[model samples]
Target: MYRFLITTSKGLEQLLQQEIQHLLPEIETRNRPGQVVFEAELADAYRLCLWSRLANRVLLQLRSGKGETGDELYDLANKVNWSSHFSADQSFSIDFVGTSRAINNTQFGAMKIKDAIVDHFKDLFDTRPNVEKQFPDLKFHGRLNKEGFGIYLDLSGGSLHQRRYRERAGRAPIKENLAFAVLMRSGWVDAIRNGDESSAEIPVFDPMCGSGTILIEAAQYAAKIAPGLHRHQWGFSHWKGHDIPLWFSLLDEAKVGQITPSMRFLGTDIDAHVIEIAKDNANIADVGDFIQFEVADATQQPNTFEKAGYIVSNVPYGERLGELTELLPMFKSWGGHLKQAFPEWHLSLLTSDRDMLRQLRLMAGKEYQFINGNIECQLVNFHLDEKNCHIADKEQDNHSDFANRLRKNISKLKKWLKTANTDCYRVYDADLPEYNVAIDVYGDWVVVQEYAAPKNIPKHKTISRLQDILIAIPDIMQIEPSQLVLKTRQVQKGKAQYQKLDKSSDELIVHENGAKFAVNLHDYLDTGLFLDHRDVRQKVRQMSKDKRVLNLFAYTGSVSVFAALGGAKSVTTVDMSNTYLNWAKRNLALNGIKGAYQYPLVRKDCLTWIRECEQQFDLIFVDPPSFSNSKNMQGSWDVQRDHAGFLRLVRMRLAPGGTIIFSNNLRQFKLDPDLQDSLGLRITDISAESIPFDFKRNQKIHHCWVMQDDA
Candidate 1:
């Protein structure tokens, strides 16, 4: 009998052993951590390789002995007859695992074993096999621990999880073997086994099937298809002792083992592109006809199966804070959809984050832990029955005060919003200091900017409060969690404010008083468009008609777009960032405003450009940042300290009868009180008028003033 060791994921050793025993009942099997050991014939090893869906690799053990040092390891490996394994002309490779006292590095240990094997072959035939790393003729696995070292011939070639069917995959695709194990844990395999193929009672469905890994696995398993039937090559293919006829016999049996079982499987994804990838993968697996791939939103898609069976999916667990915030409501909504549409059906969801499971609100009947790659995950099962389905809104749980306050604020803003003709506005701005977050709406999306909690508040308490806030917002705002973007608002210095927090570039076009601007909620700390400055942008439009308009620090060109639409003869926009400048251009294009001659985009530090400018404008808007120390600028600038000198330059650029609208968000800003007399200018503080109704609660969101040259 040949000694063999089978490797699998850490938590799946027992399941893998059970699968192996069922496939080869005569073998003496023993389970270990991430591995299973058994004694079987060479043909039995091949059979297990062909049938064991949960095993990663089927290794044929050749030798095991004590090897405390590199020399000892070399001596032990050299004791084996190298010629008996393969001819010296065949290429070979070693995958060494673990460490020893003298051979702490895997490469060093592999080198020692490699030297021993080469010397053994050289002594016999005066030649040795060439080392081929990628596709070797014979692959060897070396492992060492405190007990001893063992060498193995890798008979499965590569990891069995790579079924070669999924040429394309979506984000965080589950491995094939793990998906199978999930099916087994869900009792899906047993259901299929008992049900008649002619009238299949069980229907498998995945609402969020990215590349369709799980659904494809289920379809293949239900159809009695061998997991390794399509694999053309094996680790034993080129081995000297490999019994070709026996391997062929096993391969033929696997081909014959596949039964044309009727399957009721369907997979769907919200993304149409990924659905095409899923269809391609299913076709490659030869199960395209047995399954249907469709693009449908999980939150809205209802159960289509005539009879309830199983709803299995690897629900997306957002990795980033913004993604997590967006997915929370999605989980809640999907949970509600399942409760309403697929009641009495079984639901199994795999996710990496345990906290996300709570968003479902459905009581998980059974939860099993599994490992996908290096990440530990949980497979939560739910029996969607009346008893377990807690579909009531959980927003009022422990945060009813915040929820009521939010509802009150939204109610108060409803009339004002209709009169203001703005769809994007602030729904809540730290109404209860305990919440400490500003929630803004941009069309259908919501952005939650959390101010850093006080240092005295415990971290866990802050996290709990934040979670409560996230849970309440979606239900109250009547939006999905996927439409919410979360960001931490903190004091920024230097160029830190301008640096990208993410690269999603998920920009959305939002309208304010019929003017459209592109806003990206996911990429930066601040969205491209500022809602607090909405009234100021409108004022710029009213003041710029039939005049030359200049917008300094033109962030995203919102003011410039408004000015252009307001019939400005010409508008000049200046900013140091090319990204914002391009965004400004897009905003203009969105409103059918274009032409460099009519509206010029200048890329220059606003502070330096103000000193060098010779052109005069009838209307000028200079809204500088509170603090800027961009590398592109010459020196550091603080609005509180530098306002006096900066306004002097701005005043110089104002033409006869020109009006300068100056603004800044520095809360403690005291605009040089004496600058009016010193620079011969009349400064009118419009901070109150510029403060829109939505921002009346936080009156100091920004300070605005209208300045005019006094001759």
Candidate 2:
């Protein structure tokens, strides 16, 4: 028996082992990280090349010994009978992997082995073989490390993943063998292998079939097609010991063993071009009749299957921030479509982003990690049924407590929400310290801000708790997973907090009291409207009648809109961000408050603008960031450090009897005790009254005060 080595991708080692054992049960096998080792006859190798769908390459070990130095590698290779493996008339190539202290470069090590073989032939036959890099008549693999070296005869010409049926490929196409691995993880292959006659008739479908890699793999398995039947050449084709007759006998067996599958497979892709390519690939693989390819959007595709089966595909998960926002709605709608169209079907999806899985609103019973090409991805499996069809409360100990707290908070607010005059409110505020996150409802959407867990907590524990909270909140809040947005809220310095989280540019309109304001929950960390300041904004509206208003650091101008609607003579909004300024404009126009004269927007650093301003207003509102080192300003501004001087400058711009409503969300914030004497103003602390009823759980959400001239 010849000792053979089989290589596969990371995370598929165990699967490959199982596949090999099933194919050659008599062979003694062992498993490694990315490869498997076994002792089998030559015919067993031939059988594996034809049948093993989860292997990358099958190699026969020719020789192995210590190769601590370059001379040792050459001596080890020369000891082998070179003519027995391949004749000097044929060309060969060496694929060297691993390196040792003496032979650090792979190319240099491969050159040493080639020289040893050539020198051997020259001494015996007075001639040598030529080295061919590509399309070699014979290929050999040499690996060298501190432990030693092993020379292998590469039976498969290149990686077995190149099924040769793919003449063209789409973007980021998965390898054929990797696709088979995914099928194994999804349990599609096992169901067929160990199923009854009726159980084997379950159909397979791929909704996002890019170039048909997944569907073609499923079809080949179902139709009993050999994975390597389409390849024209192999490393053993020109080997001296290769028995062409034996290879042909195995090939004939594979050809005659194929049978028509009982069930048909379906593949759909939104791109028409990709669908045509998939059709061509399917035809080349000889499974065209088994699979039906169509050009249709995955989100809107209607299920035409007579019975529930399996839906397995590689769902598109955006790698960039902007692409994620665009894909959110598609995943949500597609998830809804699956719930409505295919109720009892099993769904297995592969994605690089875990967030998209949450968007599906389906509870994954199992998840497996694998490397696709270079990307580390997750294969999440879900069984669709009426009970768990939609997002529901999870009963795990980690999840129940958080969900129970959210349910209790929502129960308390149910009556108050109906009469709160605004649909936006806070539902949960870290009620359970172990689950440290704040939840706010903006009409139909829920924004969850996860505060950084304490350093003493384990990272994995924090992650587990956060995931449990995400799974639980949707059900308690009575919203779809699409309406849930999660963000990490840590102490941000300078202008980092204001930087855009995503370029979704998506805006939603929600009402407060009688005024309408636009808020974007996805683009930035803080949605334009701060729900905790509901009471403060109303106070501003009630006090702004017939007065001129100036809103400093007016983020999206929520307060300015309320002031304009309160019949202010004129409103001025100042902020350094042109993005927020434009957003403020949209908010004003959204509420029918327009015209530059009535509401002027100035894009200047509030600190710099307040110093150069010549106009005075009857009312001024200052809610600057806790700390800002924005590039637009000459220097940074800290609420606690600069509030005294900052308000003194504002006092110069204040009309007599005018009021300045100043606020900040800094939890440890303290009003400058000497500001009353320093700015010559009477500062009344209204922080207690500023927090809305829903935010009572977190009294430090924000601090508010009404400052006026001490006349």
Candidate 3:
């Protein structure tokens, strides 16, 4: 019997050993972290090269001896009769692993091994073998440890994991061998390949199938197809001792051994481009007929399967803080969707972040540790039974807590809501630390804004709490899910505040203080109406009577609508986005104030417009975004840095004794002292008076100021 060493990933050694033991029960085996050693004949070696899915390389141990120095190692290699393994005209390459005191540099150690092989060949024949690093005819592998060194022929050549089927790969695609390990650990291999008739027919699916690696691996295993059947080259093909006739016979046997089982394998990805690539890869593997690939979102996966099966996926594990925040609720929703749709299906999820897996809320039955590249990841397996399908008891407690807080806040705000005669108000503003979300009511609709959780907070905990909030809001408020809009609030940079979050151009008319304004909850990051500014809009209306009003940097012209409704002589609304300008006109029309002469909307750079305008206004409202760098703007704008210049321009167009109202959502804003002194302007901090009762908890939501020239 010949000795063979099969190398796999570090954590997959035990599974590899078990696989080999099953394939050749009588073979003696030893397992290590990344390697499995066994004794078998040439036929077994050929079989392993053709069939073993977890092995990266199948090597034949040519010789082993002890050596301390590079020269000694070269001598050990020289005694192996290099010319017998490959001809002088054949090209070869050497791969050295591990390190010794004398072989500190792997490249130098490889040179020493190559020197021995070349000298041996040169001594036998006048010429030596050529070195071919890329596609070598014969490949040699050497391992140098503290004890000595072992050299072997890399029988499988360029890693067996490079299954010839994948013509393309998606970002961070799991290696085919690792995908095999995932399938094996999930018990899918046994269920699809060797299980009883009923188990063999169970369907397999991957919802987040990137380039369809898992699906392809599953299809091949289910079909009893050899992993290496389609390979064009192998190290044994050119080896001097290779049994050509025996190898061809084994290949023919593998071809005939493929089982056409009646099994279904499906793969879906939200990215259509990646789905096309997956199709190409499946076609290349000759298993396209066994697997179906489609562009589908995991959140919308249908429960059309008539029978229970396995759902395996490598869901996205965000590597950065921002990505983690975005992925939290997505994982939570995906978990809920899976529970509601596939209560009987089993799940195997591979992720680097265990917290993300916990967001699924399903208790995993088994977890296997594996190294995906350098990241330590876990393949968590779960059997979704009735007991574990619902939200845990602790999660229910969180939901109750959120509900109680919402009720308390609403009760406290009832008096203010009645006095203001407004149906829309802030019901909850992060009342509890765990459930950090702002709940606003616009008539029957509720908008839930989730503040970005601290980086130290576990993503699963945040997601669990968010799920609790979502469940609590509808139950507490007695509204449908369609009326609740969820949004994530993060520190936006540049023009991110103005950027559209979705493509739906849906607009709804909502009442605020007996006035009608158009609001869009689905199209943009911020709904059209700012509920916190309800009192501020009323203040603008009270002060705008018989005055010519200028609403600078006006977004949707809600302020202008209030000014016009309060009987302003004329109102001019200035903004950069034509979309918002059109929205401003629509808001004016909604409020029964029409005609361009009544409320004129100007779409232009507010800064440039202010510079060129000569008209004087009795009241001017400037509420520039905290920061903006829109392509239409002249240059980037920062409220803190450019407030002086922007205000100076606003002052130049203001009539004597006229008031300039400035407001911004930058919580940390500080007015420049020099501007106050230089412009001789009397400024009052009206932030406290501008805040409505519903926003008492977070008074710093915005800062407002009224500036007047001390003429």
Candidate 4:
């Protein structure tokens, strides 16, 4: 029997060992973090490489010895006859790992091994083999660590994970072997063949299937198809010691072993473009007829199968705070849908965030830890029985506490709302420390903003609190679930503030102090109208009667819409993004205001446009972002660093004695004294005046100033 070593991912060593034991039962095996060593015959090695799904590489042991210096490593490598493995015409490459005291550089250690092989061949046959780094005929692997040195011939050409079927992959695609491990740990194979003939046809579904990796793997497993059979070449195919006839016989057996099983594999994704890519990959794997692809959202998965089977998915892990905010509510809604529609189906979710998994409220039966490309992750298996489907009273207690806080805050803000004659306002802003979310009212609609949780708090606990908040908002606010909008509040910098979180084009007309504007609660992190700027928009209306007005850095042009309605002689709105420019025009048309030159919307960088403008305005609204590095802009913009220069440009076009209303949401802002001295302008702080009564608790939400040239 010959000794062979198999390598896999760090946490999958045990599973690989079990797989090997099943294929070759009499083989002696030893396993570690990423490698499994075993004693088997050459035929068994060939069989293992052909059928093993969880292995990354298979290497045949050639030599092992202790070596501290480069010369000693060369001596260990030279002990093997160099000409037996491959001829002088064949090309080869060396892959070196680990470092020792003497072999500080891996490249230097590899060079020593190469020299020894070439010298041995040159002295014997008067010629040496060529070294091809990209696609070599023979690949050598060397390891040098604290234990000692090992030299082996890689029997598996490249990484076995490259199944050669996926011509392309989607963003953050999980490796094929990793997907196999998930299926094994989740009992997918056992569930399909549980002695009941009816179970053999149980359906498998992946809602967030990206490039259909899991679906292809499941189809292959159910149909009894070997993964390596799709590849055209392998490391052993060109080796001199390879038994060509024996390999073909095994290949023919694997091909004949593939059976047409009665299994339904379905995959769905939100992106239609990616669904086509997944279909192409499935066809290449020869499982196209077994699997079906469609475009569907995870929150509202289609119940296509009559009987309950399995729902396995690699859900999104929000690496950014904004993404976390968006995914939390989606997970909660998906959980509710599964409990209602597919009560008997089991779920196996893989994600980096355990809290996200807990949002489903289903008790996980078993959990396995894995490392997916440096990110630690968990695969949680849930048997969705009646016992786990219902929410326990203890979970309801958290929701009750949040509702009580919301009710008390609404009672306190009720009188102020009536006095101001407003239907939209803020009801809750972290009144209780444990429930950290901001609640706002837009008539019958409510928008909830979750503040970023502290790093020290356990992520699962934070997610639990968010789920509780979502459950309480509709009940306490006496509104339907569709009216509640949830978002995560983060300190956005650069163009991230304008990034679209969703593609819903739904818009609503909301009133603020007798002026009507459009508000889209679903499409963006911030609603089209800033509720804190309610009083500021009113101020713009009061100051813009029949005056030539210019709105700079106008986002969505809510203030510009107000200025036009207030009888401004001319309104010039300037912004960079065409999306916002078109939105501003729609807002204008919605209010029955229309004109070409009378109310023109310019799609240009406000900072650059201001320098080129010669026309004067009686009133200018300047609300620049706190920080912006948009690629369309000339240079980076920081409100604090570039405010003085930006204001100087605005002053040149300010019809003499024109008023500039400068506002931003930077909480810790202090106007530069040098700017005030250089421009000879009189400045008044109207930050307190701009805030509506609902925003009294957080007075520093925005900073506003009235600047006038005192020349």
Q: Cα miss at 585, model 3 (Å)? A: 11
Question: What is the lDDT for 475 in model 1?
Answer: 73
- How does each model score on lDDT? 0.87, 0.86, 0.85, 0.85
Clashing pairs in 1: 326-481
List, residue by residue over 305-361, the lDDT tens digit for candidate 4.
978888888888877443554566577778878877788788998998888776687
- Distance (Å) between predicted and true CA of 516, model 2? 3.1
lDDT of 3 by residue, 620-663 (tens): 99999988888888988899999999898888888888889999
Where does model 4 exceed 4 Å of error? 67-80, 99-128, 164-174, 188-225, 252-347, 372-375, 384-386, 389-428, 439-448, 470-487, 492-529, 545-689, 693-697, 703-711
TM-score of each: 0.77, 0.70, 0.65, 0.72
Error of 3 at 413 (Å): 8.4
Q: Rank the candidates by TM-score, best first.
A: 1, 4, 2, 3
Alpha-carbon shift of residue 660 in model 3 (angstroms)? 1.9
Candidate 3's displacement at residue 239, Å, is 5.0
Query: lDDT ranking from best to worst?
Result: 1, 2, 3, 4
Clashes of 3: 0
